[model samples]
Target: MLTRKQMELLDFIRTRMGTDGVPPSFDEMKDALDLKSKSGIHRLITALEERGFIRRLAHRARAIEIVKLPEAMESGGFRPRLVAEAAPPPPPPRGALAIEPVHALELPVMGRIAAGVPIEAIAHVSHHVAVPGSMLSGKGQHYALEVKGDSMIEAGINDGDIVVIREQTTAENGDIVVALVEDSEATLKRFRRKGNMIALEAANPAYETRLLPDHAVKVQGRLVGLIRTY
Candidate 1:
């Protein structure tokens, strides 16, 4: 028998693929189960794959295929545990402004970006978040990254916040940007040009500034906004 968590994950994958014709991403699975880490989602997925409940296609992103679903879900009796165990949200009062349906723009949430030490960039799109077009500013393509450190806490960007970034190769001074250093590592910092050097400045005093020649730094994107899940 599948554990409750495994059952929950399997149900989610089936439901999502049935709706969207694509398997949900790791981050989506994590959010669906109220999981604290993607590692937990990975473990659960591996268990399902091992049990013949799902198949992961090789050389693909979000390429999971559901082979079997729990009887509970198949019978239409399985409400997601995260939803079933939680209290229902109160209904909006009558005559409250009707919510207008707005189209959402889905952006890839790439792997985590460091706010301190630069980390090797992961090119795969792990998950995505849908934000209304109004939430974004420019016409440039955008992507999202999860902040992993408190190096920018002084600037109100905290660990665990998902930052929406506008793709660009150049940034103005004082703009918070995702910078690719030496074409290998990526970091989130304030962009600065001082004399002949390009500086990636941390918002918090605890971290020292990194200075390199202008050619060594590539501006990946500028901060657009952020999504923080409660």
Candidate 2:
């Protein structure tokens, strides 16, 4: 039998994966369960894994596979989604030099970025995701963020899409960027400047453009490329 916290965590993970095609980050789980620290989450995950409830992928950040559901969840007709394992490539021809695959690099997924209302600034690395090197722009450093809202839908950015960001402290007008608001909250929006004011514009008509003092906005990074999983 699973503990109450364990069941809650499992249900949360399954629900997030079903919605976003990715599991929630440790911080998110911590917040959802109202736990004081991530250590509690770690222990609960270990317990679930020991019970054959989930599998954590080695060397992958935040990668988890749901192995089975409890009887209660099963009666609800929940179907676990299985991630197919990639088969090993055939051995190179005898005497042929083996070449490593190119153009793919592992980038840290910092955390979720809000595309609608601004959320707390994400400063820690949650996990790493493999991104095509070509997706990176002329960058000093690059990172990935899971988008969390639909305000940028008109720009072709959707909730659950992974956005590749080139770290920078500046942006041109109309460029979509990760904007840190008041040094506390972060959002994904188009950047616009007028006089000494900065405008964070949302693509969707439902969201009004937020105009703030230039000093209140900081450009964390600019959007480079996006990846979406069906």
Q: Give the candidate number with the greatest lDDT.
A: 2
Query: Model 1: residues >4 Å from true position, as ranges?
Result: 1-96
Residues 128-187 of candidate 2 have per-residue lDDT tens digits of 677777777884667789999999999999999999888777899999999988766899
Model 1 earns a TM-score of 0.58
For candidate 1, write residues 1-230 as lDDT tens digits: 55445766887888898899998889899998777899989988888898898999999888888887655456553231111223444666898865554646777676689998898865445566776678778775677889999999999999999998887777899999998887668899999999889999999999999999998987878998999988
TM-score between candidate 2 and the true structure: 0.58
* Candidate 2, residue 28: lDDT: 98
